[model samples]
Each structure stands twice: as C-alpha cells, then as structure tokens.
Target: MYYIGIDLGTSAVKLLLMREDGKIENVVSREYELSFPHPGYSEQNPEDWYRQTLDGLKALVSVVDPKEIGGISFGGQMHGLVALDEEDRVLRPAILWNDGRSIEEVRYLNEEVGKKVISGYTGNIAFAGFTAPKILWMKNNEPELFARIRKIMLPKDYLAYRLSGSFCTDYSDASGMLLLDVKNKCWSAEMLKLCGITEDMLPKLYESYETVGYLKPEIADSLSMRHDVVIAAGAGDNAAAAVGTGTVGRNKCNISLGTSGTIFITADSFCVDSNNALHAFAHADGHFHLMGCMLSAASCNKWWMDNILKTDRYAKEQTGIVRLGENHVYFLPYLMGERSPWNDPMARGAFIGMSLSTSRADMTQAVLEGVAFATRDMYEAAGSAGITPERTMICGGGARSPLWRKMISNILNISIDIPACEEGPGIGGAMLAMVADGKYSTVEEAAAAIVAVKSTCEPEPELVKKYEERYQSFRKLYPALKTVYGEL
Candidate 1:
C-alpha cells in the first residue's frame, strides 16, 4: 500500500508519496503567494492552499496506482488563524504564524490577563505569533469579520477539512493555538472564554496519528483515488519533524535550523520551564516536549548573502573564514524580533564589536556564529528543565551547511546527528499515515523503522571551549541592547 504526506508550508505545499516499506516514491511541490497588506502582518488565501495541494497531489500520484494509496496525512505550519463562516466559506485571509501585528494583544495577555494565568491554562505564555493573540487582533481590528466566524482552524487543518470534510485537528498542532490545555490534551475552557469563542467553534481534537476521516467523494474522484483512503490527524511541522528524525522517546532532541531555528526536546512527562522560556506542548508520540524557537536562522544568512552581499556564492564566502569561533566581531540575530527565551518582538538585529580591522569574512562568520549562539540559548533553557541532550538530530536548510552544523555542535557542546533523509515534516506525515493505516503500531515504532542516521558531527574539546567563551560574550550583547531595542 502507499501513503501520502502533505506538508502545508508557509510558502508552498509539499506532497510526498511513499510505500509501506518506508521508501519515498515521488515528491511534488507547489508554491503560492504570501500577501503583506500592512507592516508586520502576513496573510494567505485558504483557497490557494487547497488548490495548490490538490494540484500537487495530482502530480505526486500521476504514475502510481491510485487504488493502492491507503492513507493520507499532513504536517503543516502551525498557529495561523483560518476563520470560516457558517456556510463554510473562508471569512478572511489567514493570519500567519510569522505575522507580528498582534503585539498589543500579546502584551494584554501577558500583562493584563497575566502570564501565570495564561500559562496555567495553556502551558505557554502569549507571543505575538500565537493564535490567541491573532484572534484578539481580529476581534479588535476586524470586528465585522470576527463576528461572522463559525469555525477557527489552523493553516493545515483548513486543508484537512477541505479534503476529508471533517473539522478536526491533532494535539500537536492544537497546542500552539494557546486555546488547548496542552498538559491535559483538551481545549481549555478558560482560553475559549478569553478568545470569546465556544468549544463548538473549535475542531475536534485527535492524536496526530489517529484517523480523522476518509477522503470526501468529490475529492477522491478529483484525485482518482479510493474514497476509503484514511485521513490521519497530523502534527505541527516541528513535532512532525521530530518524529521524522526519530526524536520520539524521552531525552531525545532535534534541532531544526530552517528559516526559523528550534531546539525540540522530548520528555516522557509534562514539563514547563520556570521562566516559561520554552513551549511545553504534547508531542505527536503521545508524550510531552519542550520547544525553543528563534525567529531568524537560515533567513539571516540568506539576507546577508543574497540582499546585502549581492551574491549566491555561499560556499565561496564561508570558505574564507577558517578562524571558527575566534572572530572578534559578534552578531545578534534578531532580524524578525525573536522568540524562545527572549520573547521580545521589539528586538532587532545588530553587528556589535566591529572595528576598522574587521573584514567582510569576520562579519559573515559572525552571522553564522550568532545563529549558533542563539541556538545555545534554547539549549540552556532545556537544561534548566533538567533535560540535558548529549546529542541532537539536525534537520532543515541550514543543516546542509557542514560549517553551520559543526558550529552548532561545538558551540552547544553536543553531538549533531544528520538524518539519512532530511525531508523532515513531509516524511513524518507519511509515517503518521502509515501508522494510521496500521502499518506500524505506534509513532515510535514507525520512526525506529523509517529514520536513519547519515553521519554524526562531534564537538572537539578545544573548539568547544573557544565557542563557549564566545557564547558567553554573545549572551551579554542581547541584554545590553534590550532597552535600546524597546526604544527603537
């Protein structure tokens, strides 16, 4: 039998076709437009997602026998607000996870309502990117549209509903919404009341691998697929990526150095950081995990190489820096504000400690080291929660760089394992589909069978010491500039 995993990303929908034997058969991607009507706001049409996904699926399975496709699942961008009316029509463009227009709403929730109360209800403090803040933003700024909302869906759930005709979401995805009682694995009544929404307005929650429904008749016909294809309730992109990396069991870690960087630490039981620096959310494996996210990672490198430096010779540029962590210049990577330990959206990027002696290579190396140092901030937060990861599985676009991976391993003083297949969430989605189809008994079993390590990057003791000292200096730069960031 075959399974399909739809990775509904921010910029595009990636569809993967896999066999039950853990072999990927085909992959297709379809890009869509992202709209920025105002500053700090990001929006997308729900219809574009569905249309692109359908088209991508058509191409994904063009050469396969459609009747052999047993199941479908998804891994998608989390926390975008997708509102629907009573007639099931999209009420407005989705408010994306990257959108920072809800700063005031975030402040109100964190200050007025209190972080303790919010954290007690949802196991997380309010951030500008969270769904709860977006809902408040809509309610306050677009009252007419908010009043017409019949259902509130996350970005991926909207696609799931369109395909399966079932209004459902998985715990891993729902946890990011700030509307779910993450520790209890249910919708939080207090959060619902605060959002001015009822439980009925939310999708029925399921475990990420649980079967939600079958394909709708029309959808099945359009794709020339079997109507009985099981639809599994998939997970948030990060959680699904963790599954893909086999970072399922307790004490396991996965570091994603994508456009946004994250340190995901899986735990056997529920654990929240004392400072609420990390997100405590339910994992796709039916356990709990803490996550720390940095808003800019590879994107920072892209900005420097593409826009500022005016070159795509990334390897050429990186080759000039043989000094590793000994560079005197330091960079603070807060290009799009920041998340994780800081949670300060007002924070901005800066290149500190530069002098006339500083070379172009020094600044370039600083950008890469800056991201690695920031990743260490999250690593330390996980340590505070009593979870020390000796080694971590690395994924994402930035992970392709050997220098960056080495930097992360040495700076954090942990081994970095590269996955044989770095498809991340897309592959994890297919693995979940296989589980939902009973090809595997549990997510762990599927992960153990499917995930393979390609190589390992170990930290050298000497390099580790140097990076540790550099990290100490990098840490102070942010606090010293925090007050200045607020004024800016």
Candidate 2:
C-alpha cells in the first residue's frame, strides 16, 4: 500500500509519496505567494492553497500505480484563521499566523481580559498571531464580515474539508488557536464567548492520525487515485515534523531550525506552565506536548548573510568564525518581535556590545550564537515546567550547518541527533496517512519503524560551561532593553 502526506507550508505545498515499507517513492512541491497588504500584516488566499495542492497531488500520484495508494494526510502551517460563509465561500484571505495586525486585540486579551484568566481557561495567553486574537481583530474592525462567519478553520483543515467534505481538525493544530481547552482536548467555552463566537463555528476534533473521511469522488478522479483514499485529520507543521523525526511518547524531543525555531517535547500526561510560557498542546501521537517557538531562528542568519553581508554562500561565511562563546558581540533576534516567553510586540532586534575592534567573524558568530541562546530561553522554560529531555532530534535548513548544530548542542547541554531523511513535515504528514490507513498500529509504531537517526552531536563539557555563562549574560539583555524597545 502507499500513502500521501501534504505539507501545506507558508510558501508551498509539499507532497510526499511513501510506500508501506517506509521508502519515499516520490516528492513534489508547488509554490504559492504570501501577501503583505500592509506592514506587519500577512495574508494568503485559501483558493490558492487548494488549487496548488490539487496540482501537486496530480504530479505526486502520476508516477506510482494508483491502486497502491491507501490514504492521505496533511501537516500544515498552524493558527491562520480561515472562515467560510453560509454558502461555503471564503470570507476573506486567511489571516496568517505571522500577521501582526492584531496588536490592539492581543493587548485587550492579555491586559483587559487578564492574562491569568486566559491561562486558566485555555492554558495559553494571547499573541497577535493566535487565531483568537485574529478573530477578535475581525470582530472589532470588520463587523459585517465577522457576522457572516459560519465556520472557523485552520489552514490544513480547509484542505481536509475540501477533500473529504468533512469539517474536521486535529488536536495538535487546534491547540494553537488559543481556543482549545488543551488539557481536555475540547474548545473552551469562555474563549468562544470572548471572541463572540460559539461552539457551532468550531470543527470536529480528532487525533492527528485518525481518519476523518475518504476523498471526494471528483478529487479522487482528478488525481487519478482510488476513491477509497482515506483523508486523515493531520497535525500542525511542528507536531508532524516532530513525529517525522520520531519524537513521540514520553520524554522525546525535537528541534526544528527552519524560518522559525521550535523545541517540541512530547509527554505522556498533560501539563501546563504557570505563566503558559510554553504552549500546552495535544501531540500527534494521541498524547500531549509542550512547544516553545522563537519567531526568528535561521531567518536571522539568512538576513545577516544574504541581506547584510550580500552573500549566498552561507557555509563560506561560517568558515571564518573560530570561537563559539567568547565573542563580546551579541545579537537579539527579535527582528519579527517575539512569541514564546516574551510576547512583546515592541521588542526590536539589536546588536549589543559591538566595539571598534569587533571583526566580521565576531558579528557572524553572534548571529549564530544569538539564535542558540534564544532557543535555550525556551529550553529553560520547558525545564521550569518539569519537562526535560536528555537528547533531541534536529531538522530543517539550519540543522544542516555543523557549526550551528554544535552550538545548539553545547549551549543547551544536550545531545542533538540528525535524521537520515530531512524531509520534515511532509514525511510526518505521510507517516500519519500511513497510520490512518492501518499500515501502522499507532504513531509511536510508525515513527519507530520509519524514522532513522543517522548521526548525533554531543556537547563537550568545557564548551558547555562556556556557553552556560554566555547564556546567563544573554538572558539579562532582553529585560534591560524592554523599556528601551517601547521608546523606539
């Protein structure tokens, strides 16, 4: 049997074809555009996502025997608000998770509504990017459009709904909306009231591996696949990526160094941080996980190397740096503001302690180390909640850098493993499809059988010690600059 995993990302929809035996047969990607209608606001059309996904599926299924295909699933960008009217037309371009238009709404939720009350109800505080804030933004600014909202959906759920004609979502993706009563895996009534929405607007929730329904006859015919192709309720991009890296069950960890950085740690039981610093979300494996995200991770390096330094050879830039933690130069990677621990939109990027003698190598090293230090900020927050992992699986574009990987390992004082296949969320979405098709017994079984760790990066004791001190200094810079960020 065969399965297809669709990774609906911000830029493209990546389709992966995998056989039951764990071999990836074919992979294809189709790009889409993200529009910034105004500064700090991001949007995308749902029609574009569905159109490209259908095209990508045709290309993916064209190579293999159609009869061998079993099921399909998705791993998608989380927290984008997709709304539909009574007749099922998209109400507006989806307010993407990265959109910062909800600044006033976010403040109202966090301050006026009270952070403690929010944390108590939903196990998370409001962020400009979360679905609830975006819903509130629409409610306040676009009341006529808001009144027509009959259904509220996430990015991938829109694809699933269009495919199976089932209005469904997975627990993993729903958690990011700031609407789920995460511990209980249900929508929070209080949150619904706060956003002036009701339970009827929400979709049915399922585990990431559960099959929602089968493909529609027309979709199946267009892709030349079996009509029995099961449509599994897929996960958020990070959760699916974690599952792809085999970060399932208790005490498992995965770090993704893509455009954004995340530390995903899975658990057997539900737990929430006091301040809700780390997200308490249901995992893809029918359990729970805590995630801490840094808004800019590898993107920080990309901005420095491509825009500032005017170079595309990233490896060549890293070769000039010699020392890991000794540089006096420090960078605060709040270029896109920030999310996780500090939900401050006023936070801005800054370079601290730069001197006349600081060389180009020092500045470059600071960017790399700055991301590591920021990642460690979340690592510490996870530890505060009594969750700690001895080792973590690492993936994404930045993970390819040996120096960056080593810096992460030493700074966090934990071992980092590299997977043989860096297919990421696309592979994880496929793995969920396999499980939903009955190719695997459970998410853990699928991960154990399919995911392979090819190498490990271990931290040296002396380097870890040096980084521990540097991280201490790094933590103090943000708070001291908090007042300054407001003035600017």
Candidate 3:
C-alpha cells in the first residue's frame, strides 16, 4: 500500500508519494499565485490551490499503481481564513498567514478584549496573522461577505473539502485560528462570540491522524486513484514539519526555516508561555507543543537573491560569504512584519550598519545571519519557559544551506541535527497518512521509523561566542526601530 501527503504552502503545493514501508516513492510540486491587493494584505484564490494540487497529484500517482494508494493527508499554512457560503461557494480569497492587514482587529482583540481574557479562551493572544482578527477585519470591511459565510476553514482543510467532500480540520491546524480552545481541543464559544461567528461556521475537528473520509468518487477517478483512499485530518505546516523531523515526545525540538521560520518544541502536557511569546498549541502527535513563528525566514534569502541580486545561483552566491558571525552589516528580517516575542505588524525589514565598503557578500551574509538571529530569539523564549533541548532537528529549504545551518547552530549554541530526508511538511503529512492507515499504531512509532538524523552540526565555542555578541546587538535593533516602524 502507498500513502500521499500534500503540503499546501504559500507559494506552492508539494505532493509526496510514500509506500507502506516508509520509502518515499515520488514528490511533485506546483506553484500558485499569491496576491497582495493592498499594502500588508495578502490573498490567494482557493481555486488555484485545487487546480495545482490535482496537477501535482496526477504526477505523483503516475509513478506507481494508483490503485495501491491507501491514504492521503495534508499539511498547510495555518490561520488563513477560507470562508464558504451557503452553496459551498468560496466567500472570498483566503487571507494567508503572512498577511499583516489585520492590525486594527489584532489591536482590538489583544487590547479591548484583553490578552488575559482572550488567552483564557484560546490559549493565545491575537496577532495580525491569526484568523479571528482576519474575521473581524472582514466583518468590519466586507459586511456582506462576512454575513454570507457558512463555513470557515484553514487552508489545507479547504483542499480536504475539495477532494474528499469532508469539511473537517485537525486540532493542530485549528490551534492557530484564534477560534479553538487549544488546551481543551474544541472551539471557544467566547472567541466565536467576539469574532461574530458561530461554532457551526467551523469545520468538525479531529486529531491529525484520524481519517476524515475517503476520496470522493469523481475526484478519485480524476487522479486515476482508488476510491477507498482514506483522507486523514492533517496538521498545520509547523506541526506536520515537527512530525517529519521527529520532534515528538517531551522536550523534543525542531527548527523550520521556510517562508516563515519556527522553533517547535513538543511537550507532554499543555503549557503556555508567561509572556505568550511562544504559542501553546495541540501537537499532531496527540500531545502539546510550543511554537514561535516569524513571518519571514528563507523568503528573506529568496528576496535578496531573486528580487535584489537577480540571480538563481543561490549556492554560488553563498560560496562568497565566509565571514560567519563577524559581518558588520546587519539585516532585520521583518519583510512581512514579525510574530513571536514582538507581535508588531508595522515592522519592516531593514539593513543596519552598512557602509560604502560593504560588499554584496556582506549584505547576503547579513540576510542569512538575520534569520538565524531571529530563530535564536525564539530559542531564548523557549529557554525562559524552562524547555531547553540539547539539540534540534533542522528542516526547510534554508536548511539545505550548510552555511546557514552552521550559522543557526552557532547562533543558538546548540547541536543541529540534519534529517536524513529534509522534505519538511510534505514528508510529515505522509507520515501522518501512514499512521492513519494503521501502518503504525501511533504517530510516535511512525516518526521513529520514518525520521532519521543524517548528521549533527555541533556549535563551536568560538563561533558561538562571536554570534552571542552579534545577537545581542541584533536584538537591540528591533527595539530601537520599533516605534519608527509604526511611524513608517
């Protein structure tokens, strides 16, 4: 038997084909358009996701007997509001997790409603990237559309609805919506009232490994797949990536450097950060985890390489950077604002301490170091909560860079484990499907078998000391320019 894991991302849908024995048979990716209709606002056509997913699925199933495919699941960007009308029509373009247009609504939820009250209900405070704030933004700005909303969903659940005809989401994905009572594993009635939405508007919730339904007949036929292919309730991208990196069990950790960066820490019990810097949420492994998410990570490097440097040669560009933690130029990676620690939506990316003698390599190095510095910010937050890992598994496109991995290891002054297969959420989704199919009795068992550490990058004391000093300086930049960000 084979299983499929679909990782629906901000820029693309990545599909993976995994066998019952845990071998990855094939992987395919398809890109889609991300729209910014207004400054700080991000949107995407849900239809684009369905079309590209179908195209990618066809390619994935072509490698093996399609009839052998046993199950399918997903891992996707969380907190994107995908509302459906009475007729199941998409109410509006999905507001992505990186969108920062809900500042006013976020302020209301965090201030007017009070963080203590909101956190009591949802175990989280409001951020511009959270779905409840987006809901309020819509209700205030697009009253007609908000009134018509009949079903609300996270991004991957929208895909599940399209393929399986099931309207459901897993607890792990729903945790970011500001609508779920995360610690309780259910919708928060208080949050629903505050957002002017009903519990009925939300999808049915399930654990990440639970099978929601099998494929719809026509949709199965479209991909030449088995109609009995079970669809598992998948996870949020970070949770799914955590599963992929084997960051399950108490105190296990994984660092993901995707479009957004995250430090994921798995816990045996529900616990919240005192300052709410790290999100306390349900984990895909049926426990709990704390995650610190930053709006931009690898995207920073991509922006510099594609938009600024105008080159596709990432490796070549990185080869010239040898300064490590010694670069005088510094980059604040707030390209799409920031989350975790500082929930400032008005924050913007900037370079500090650049001089006329600053070469292209210095600026490029600054971008990489900036992300690493931001990642460490979360690591320190986790430390304050008394959850420190001796080492962490690292995944994502940015993790492919040896230079960046070294920087991350030294910046945090911890050992970094490189997964044998670093496909991130795509592989994690497949592992969840494998669990749903009964290939493993539990998610932990599946993870132990599927996730492997290929190598470990140990932090050098000298490099760690240098980065510690650099990080202190990096930390000061955000505070110094914070007020200026709002003025801008």
- What tens digits encode model 1's per-residue C-alpha lDDT throughout 380-402? 99888888989999999899999
lDDT of 3 by residue, 457-479 (tens): 99999999999999999999999
Q: Which stretches of candidate 1 lie over 4 Å from their true place?
A: none
* TM values, all candidates: 0.99, 0.98, 0.99
Distance (Å) between predicted and true CA of 106, model 1? Answer: 1.0
RMSD of each: 0.9, 1.1, 0.9
Go through the candidates in order and give each one's C-alpha lDDT. 0.93, 0.92, 0.93
User: What alpha-carbon RMSD in Å does predicted model 1 have with respect to the real structure?
Assistant: 0.9
For model 2, the run of ten residues with the poorest summed lDDT: 272-281
The residue ranges of model 3 lying beyond 4 angstroms of the native Cα positions read none
